[model samples]
Target: MKTDVLIAGAGPVGLTMASELSRYGLSVRLVDKNTQRTDKSKAIVLWARTLELINRMSPNCADRFIETGLKTESVNILSGSEHIGHADMKEVDSKYKFVVMIPQSDTERLLEEHLATFNIKAERQTELTDFKETSDGVTYVLKHADGSEETAEASWLIGADGAHSIVRHKLNKEFHGSTLLSDWMLADIYLTGVQGTPAINIYWHADGILALFPLQGTRHRIIANVGESSGPIGEGNRPAPTVEDIQRVLDTRGPGGIKAEDSVWRSNFSINERKVDDYRSGRVFVAGDAAHVHSPAGGQGMNTGMQDAFNLTWKLALVSRGICQPEPLLSSYSAERSPVAKVLLEFTGRATEAALLRGGVKQSIRNHVASLVLGFAPVTHTMANLLSEISIGYSDSPLNAHTQHPRHGVKPGKRALIRENEPPVGFGDAPRFALFAESNNLPSALLLKYSALLEATPRAPLSPDSLSLVRPDGYVALATKSGDWNAVDAYLNQFLPKAS
Candidate 1:
């Protein structure tokens, strides 16, 4: 078999990788060892940024997701009977302000549906047993359930497999991080008497953290820290919690009058904060849990991985089409994403530590500080933006360039807004950079020179005296003054294919 890209794992992250590649007109083969998609609701929140990327791929598909998933607008934090703080997601600077509460199972289902529009289907029960890389491409073998082995070749291999990724192990990358000592329990159950509007309810009791994420209908996902681990982390010798255990934790930690029953899924697991040194090694690369794993405190585990797929797919598509040089385009993937994973790890670790604080005096101080800090509008708005992930940018990215003079509105390496009536940067079969400038002419000769890699017509600038080059993923690549064609040319030349 032959393909442009071979993706391992059929989970949400892998599905995202495959879907984006397919949408970009790349030939992708998605495979997984599991016979069926996940039925369990593991990772459940779709942040604003993730939804924005999905909409960039297909607006109608995103509409379906919104219709099926519940929209949560705020998060309420409490300490026993005392209310600590509330984060209003309405302040997020995007058209879609609320977090979409959809199950991972639902996410996979929808992504698979989207991929079908491109006539691509995941080959289930097919596992990547081994692989090797050559001078220009990669050779891989897939083992079917019947024990038959099929050999294939591809230009690139993506490892979006889960934490115990066979591809990561084969690449000899060390998943460097520590296993958190506390044991956590997650329960997806039907509940009654949920207080307030549909919002995330967090209780920082003296015992530990109890978080309630609202799901579709009466369903809710309850996750809590069950104190120190008595046994080893991996084997999970600890038994699954019952409805009574869930009730006990809620009664002790959450506000009164809520009841949980009719359990759907319940399991105990330990948190691990680990990531590889790089996201890519030659023709092979890792995304999702294969690249990083951290605490699920902010529900960013899946969103970050999906965004990883978003970041890599466009560059892969552009390079595969010979529209951009491979070195800087591909190398920037690790440079831009590695730091993001590190920041996420540290942020989640701090949140987990804060929730686990013990002793009366320390707990009181923590509650007081949280209340006072979150009371301010700027504090709440910033926290809301962080949680929604709309504030993520690549200002430090190697791909970003600047002019001598600064411009207003969106800065280079930051996110540039897409007008409500305008198509997104990467809307067509190929990924093309959008040029925003005050001048209407924009030297059509220059655009024609790189038509395959750039949009044909220049878009009206959002601000006067500003010219911006926006990446396919909707981030500003170059922000300069009007008619700074030299700056734009230099930036594109870095990734543009060299002249023959």
Candidate 2:
């Protein structure tokens, strides 16, 4: 059998890759070794930037997530019973300002449903056992639950297969990082007598860190650091936290007078901070946990993985359809996303270390500094943007281009703001750049020449002096002075097929 893309795994990241590729009219075969999706409520929050990317996939698709999940408007930091500071989600510049709290299971189900609209369904109980990449495509083998094997060919292959990825292993790429020795407990349960707005609460206690994430209705998720681990880092080896265990932590760490009951899920696991230096190897690519996994401090693990899918698929679609060359266009994927993952790992690692500080003068000093720093509006706003991932940008991306006299507004490689009632960038079947400039300012000749790669009409510019070309994934590709058509032309020329 033949397909345009062969995706391994069916988690949120894999589902996202399949959905984006299929939405772009590519043939996709999604497979997973597991017969069913996860029932556990892993990865509990979807940041604003992720929701904006989902909005581009289809109109009202992000709305489905917003409706089904809980919305958190702010995050409060506390030292035992005393309030330290808080970050307001409203400070984020995106239209979807608040973070949506949805379980990984529901996220997968929703992504699968969206992919089904394009007539693609994930093949369960099927695993990718081996593969060999050729010049033009990848030839792979799949093993079924019934001990049967099938050979297939695809123009490309993606390993969203996770940390234990067979595809990543086959590529001989090392997942470079270490697992922390500390064990943390996670619980999803119903809580009564919990005070405050629908917000994420983090309590810095003398013992460890305890966080409460509000879910739909009366349900909440609790995470706490227990102590040093005596065993390995896998979740299977760690004992599950009982309701009593959760209540004990809450009573000791959380703000006074909160009861934990009706437990739904509980598990203890160690944090692994690992990432691959490159996201791509020849015609194959690894995303999500296959490429990077970090601390859960910022709730960025799943969102980062999903964004990796968002960033790679548009480029893949353009190249696969012969609309662009395979050189710089494909190489830019790793160049763009790898740095973002590196930053995330460092940020999450710092956050985890800060929260795990043992009680002493150092812990007191840390709490004092955090409270003092977070009290500043700018500090809190920056934290909000970082945590929600609205501030992520590829300023150093190879795909970024600019003229000498570029106007000042949104610079090259920054995300253009998604305004209300306006259609997002990259909002169609074909992967094309959206032009942000006055219609009258754009020359018909320039539009005609790159019509295959550019959006038909130019939207209003950020400033009258700026002419911006935003990529299909909504990052700035070219930011030049208004009426500088030469820069735009030169930028698009790089992706054009070379003469033989």
Evaluate candidate 1 by giving its C-alpha RMSD to the native, one decimal: 1.2
Off by over 4 Å in 2: none
RMSD of each: 1.2, 1.1
The local lDDT score (0 to 100) that residue 290 gets in candidate 2 is 95
Question: Tens digit of lDDT per residue, candidate 2, span 64-152?
Answer: 99988999899998987788889899898888879999988889889988998998889999999999999889999999999999998
lDDT tens per residue, model 1, 7-114: 999999899999899988889999999999999999999988888888887864577788889999998888867889988989998888898999989999999998
Q: TM-scores across all candidates? A: 0.98, 0.98
RMSD (Cα, Å) of model 2: 1.1
Compared with the true structure, model 1 gives a TM-score of 0.98
Clashes of each: 0, 0
What overall lDDT goes with each candidate model?
0.89, 0.90
